[model samples]
Target: MRVRNKPWADDLITENPQAIVLNPEHYRGQWQSRFKSVQPLHVEIGTGKGQFLIGMAVAHPEFNFVGIELQKSVLAAALKQSLPAELPNLQWVLADGQGVNDFFEPREVTQLYLNFSDPWPKTRHEKRRLTYKSFLKSYAEVLGDGGQLQFKTDNRHLFEYSIMSMTSFGLNLTELSLDLHADVAASQGELENIETEYEQKFAAKGQPIYRLVAQFPKK
Candidate 1:
């Protein structure tokens, strides 16, 4: 479900320098300077076509938002939607999640979002999972004090694995819901919920979205 090779994609991303960062590696620690004010920074990794990031930026104007996507063609589609919104506090970057530490300074980001991330549902490929201990270490290096990672997925096995991973890694889970739509009491009151493209698609087909927020406490 990804367009890997689109000739026009790079050009669109390059042309919209105001909204998207064509050279994200150079901006590593200078992420905050690109935004209007020095607000708490929130980042979404694997921002596919960007429905979630765009909705988050529009809803919470107080926080600075960054959307990072690996695919140029996919990011191009995201840029197409965000540019016309004309949001000052929103920015996009082309990046791979595996290299988050290289992209930002220590404790640079205040919040992280993982919306419908790839489950990587194989025993040998467990390291590729976003919530893996190795990935959590990378996240801890960049996430600032009191920072937390919010996650949502439709995969039950992945969700269970994530919960176990968080516990073993000494990361605390603040909230969790195995069935976001159906489990009324477990979801607790309405969370400031924003639907990602995958969430919407799965929910329409009667699939329950699993969600959790985890953080590492300062010792």
Candidate 2:
């Protein structure tokens, strides 16, 4: 999907080599310097357009947020929206999410968010799904022990597959919601605001959003 009305695209690409770490080995002990004090980092892989990431960063100013999007054009749009806000807690990178472990140290991230990830419905594309075992292994290595992976999707098959995959990885599941909005009232005050572009669209269509929170066991 090509971005058509991308007004703030250029702003996402950071020319500063210091700010962008393509190789994970270089981050090592110095990763803390990337974000001041390293007060828990949360990463959103495939942060399409930046709506959800931007909102999360704004909502939780205490935690640092990093958005990884492969598409430079859309990444630029996200950057443009984030930069004007001058948010100290928010940062982004234009890179392949499959290589996330290479750029982050063991247990570097506190949380991971996979919102409306590509379903890749075709059987041959199963390997490409973010919740596939291969991707989950990478996330396990990068996320801190006991850290959480929060996922939301409109695809029922993907959601079911993800739950099974997460369980197979030995991750503990805590929260599961088949319909987010309907469960919101019962969830008390723990409702998080909508962040992804697809999330908004799905909500508008009265679709049930499936959500799950899985935690990696302590090593």
Worst 10 residues of 2 by lDDT: 11-20
Of the candidates shown, which would achieve the greatest TM-score relative to the real structure? Answer: 1
Q: Write the per-residue lDDT of candidate 1 for residues 39-119, one digit (tens) a residue.
A: 988999999999999999999999999898988888888998888889988998887878888888888899999989999
lDDT of each: 0.87, 0.82
Candidate 1 deviant stretches above 4 angstroms: 1-4, 183-189
Candidates' TM-scores? Answer: 0.93, 0.89
Clash pairs detected, candidate 1:
none
Estimate the TM-score for candidate 2.
0.89
**TM-score of predicted structure 1:** 0.93
Question: Against the true structure, whose lDDT is highest?
Answer: 1
